[model samples]
Target chain A: MQKVMMGNHALSWGAKLSRAEVIAAYPITPQTEVVELLSNMCADGSLKAEFIKVESEHSAMAASMGAAAAGARTFTATSSQGLALMHEVLHWATGARLPIVMGNINRAMAPPWTIWTEQTDSIAQRDTGWIQIYTSSIQEIMDSVIQAYKVAEQVYLPVMVVLDSFVLSHTNENCDIPDQDKVDAYLPRFENAYRLNTDKPAAFGGLTGPDWYYELRYKIEKDTERSLDLFEETGKEFGEMFGREYGLVETYKLDDADTVLVASASIASTARPAIDQLREEGHKVGLVRIRVFRPFPSELLRKLLAGRKKVLVIDRNISFGMSGAFYAETKAALYNEKKAPPMWGYIAGLGGRDVPLNVIRDMIEQTIAEEHPEGDIVWIGVKR
Target chain B: MLEIRFHGRGGQGTVVASKVLAFAVAREGRFVQTFPEYGVERRGAPVVAFTRIDDQKIYIRSKIYEPDHLLVLDPTLIGAIDVTEGLKPGGWIIINSDKPAKDFPQFAGFKVATVDATSIAVKHRLGSAAAPIVNSAIMGAFAKITGFVGIEAVREAVHELSPVKKDENVEAAQEAYDTAEVPKEQS
Candidate 1:
């Protein structure tokens, strides 16, 4: 049925439809509602799941690890400081090869105490070995959560379905909640050979010496590489079922375009209008929204971005002294290509600051006007 | 697309009002998006929420700068904050106030309508006078004056969304719908 629902509720519906058997979460701002509704669903017997109101984010992920180890489909949701708190367990889940699905509402890390949208929280966890997918709308948030389970279980890697805090979390949008039977057919129960079973007891996450540790790390890398293909296949299956197709990267008005702007999450959604406005004014501008961040989709990006005259990346995050994390990755992805666009990076919309239509237009115009960009990263809309 | 901006203090159901309207419109087969703009969120602090309704899907996710309509849930918010800062000329402003529409400050040449939502809330005892839950009442005036959404749509929304005060909310909305008045000059 179609309903105008909050983005946080969308995550709850996704977890319900996916038939997650165990939901362990600690409430945090912007992320609190996602699990609050889940707890209600659990209490009402609508979801038929165990809702664990853990004391901390670490306990939430740790409980999910235990549940997934015990052969249950597990899930959790958190943001910002909560995600930071779960960092240690995040690595544990990945290293244990637990196919846990988590919803990370991307919020700014606080010294000033903000509960607003920012990508730094999730971007900082890029090396944690979880497959991360950022969504731009409520429907994508729901669909990605379902697809995330399929991809994670396929390759035995945890998946983080990430979206901006309020940009999507607090926004209400029309979304089609797929029929339960259709979702059941799309994502079957999690049945894996590695799950903890009383019938076949095995040691999990035990310490490994230097001889075996390196090979286990290498295997994780190899499986992560395999996830890219699995993600495409899963996306195709989802498209056939729901009629909304998704990919690691989605392009808009790219045909016969010389300039392309790249972004992720809700900012990417905001870019469509700027691209359309520019196109109407007869500027050959396009947009490439990066949906999946982990397993980076480097090959597809290199192929799509190689021939453009200019590429502008808008990152809602920074990697401190270097550049936008996405900017550095995109550049590194195309470094060896014969024909690569001169990519410029701009950091915008941190801590839930609005990214207006004019700011987007200005970024595009600046990218077009500059012959050689002055810096590796430019701060857009900073008062200075 | 019809873009709307809502003005209310924190804890006054500003976001809830936007979502209720969005869902009502979506239930009628139109695409709708609703969200709020706030910081830190202390009660009585001014806050704004936005809603967009269209026959087609919306792509823009930024805050509405130029709203086609404004729903002001607090009378005192006028002048304190620029409630009509970006309201389009000739747009509608459905405000929650007991004063006559003409007595309210002229809002940049926009059409004005007034509803005594606080009065209706007090009559129904939905919430305390200090913090009257006026979103449902304001939404009712919005539906009746604008006619974009049917009054029954608001009733259904309140019935579904309100947990304990469903009946009272529905009555509050219905009373406001019947009692709201548009200024003669604007009408």
Candidate 2:
């Protein structure tokens, strides 16, 4: 059915459609609505799932891990501070190899206290062994949630399907929700031999001696490395089922372009029109929307970004002391190439700051004008 | 594509009004997007929300800066914020005031319309007179003036969105649809 609803509702619908047996989540701004609706669904018996309204994000994640370890499909949602609170348990979920799916509404970290959108909160969790996928629209949010389960369960890694706080979470759009039976076919019930059973009790999360711990860590690293291909495969299968195609890195008019701008989350959606406008005016500009961040999709990016004369990276979050995190990662991805394009980084639209079309056009025009930019970090829309 | 901005106070259903418009447009098989500007969360604070409707899919996630139409749900919000600031040339502004169109502030380059939505809401008992919920009535006036969306769709949307006072909302919308008046110059 097609309904015009918020991106947060799309997350809840995705969980309910996937028949997630256990949902453990705490309320947080921009993320609270997703959990609240899921709680209502659980209460009304519209969805036959266990909704655990925990006190904090830590308890929420711990509960999800517990349910997943007990052979149940688990889900959760958090943003900003709540996500920071779950940082410790995030590693625990991945180490336990639990296929827990979480919707992380990315928000700027607080010192001045903001509930606005930013990407730092989720990007900061890069080393946690979880596969992260950023979405641009509410439809993509729903679709990605379902696909996350498929990819995560296959590789035994947790999946974080992320969107910008308020930008995507609060925005309402018409989304074509897939039928439950089709979703069931795309993502089957969880079935694995490695689970806790009361009849034949087994030990889990026990202390591992240093001799054995090294190999266990190696296996996790190896599995995470394997997820790059698995993510693409899952996206392909979802495309076949739902008629909406997805990929690790989605490109717009990048086939023969000399300049390409890179962005993720909601900003990528904003970049598309700017690219279109530039194209109409006979500029050889394109946009690359990075959907999959973890396992980085470095090979795919390397392939798409090859032969381009210039690359512009737009990051809504900063790494401080360094340039934008995405720019740093993109530069690293192309480090080994003999003659990589000069990638320029621009930071824009932090903490709910509005990004107009002119700012994006300015970024492209500035990149085209300079052989070497003025600085490593170009702050767009700043007062100076 | 048509861009719209809604100006109202918090707790006045400004956000919900945009959602209903987006939903109605989507139901008509056109693509639509609706969202509000996030700011300090406080009741009675001025709030701004936006909606965009297009025959093609919308890819721009930015706020509507050049709104083709502006709907002011609260007349008092006029001087409080720049309600008409980035309005496109020859755009339309629909105000919910009962005053005559000449009595309202004039925009040299824009068309204007007025609907006594507060009176409509109060007559139908949609909410108290002090805090009249004029979202549906204003939407009704929007539909009547612009003809961008059908009146039936607005009625259906209000019925679906309002948990209580369905009849009052429907009546309020119908009254606004009938009574909405365009500026003398434009007419």
DockQ for every model, please: 0.83, 0.84
lDDT of 2 by residue, A127-222 (tens): 998899999999999999999999888888899999888889999988998999999999998895688998889899899999899999999989
Q: What is the Cα-based lDDT of residue B171 in candidate 1?
A: 93
RMSD from true fold, candidate 1: 1.5
Chain A only TM-scores, each candidate in turn: 0.98, 0.98
TM-score of 1: 0.97
- Return the TM-score for each candidate structure: 0.97, 0.98
Alpha carbon deviation, residue A163, candidate 1 (Å) = 0.8
Each prediction's total of clashing residue pairs, residues at least 3 apart in sequence or on different chains, is 0, 0
Over 4 Å off, model 1: A28-31, B182-187
Q: Each candidate: RMSD to true structure?
A: 1.5, 1.4
Error of 2 at A32 (Å): 2.2
Report the number of the highest-lDDT candidate. Answer: 1
Off by over 4 Å in 2: A28-30, B182-187
Evaluate chain B of model 1: give its TM-score.
0.95
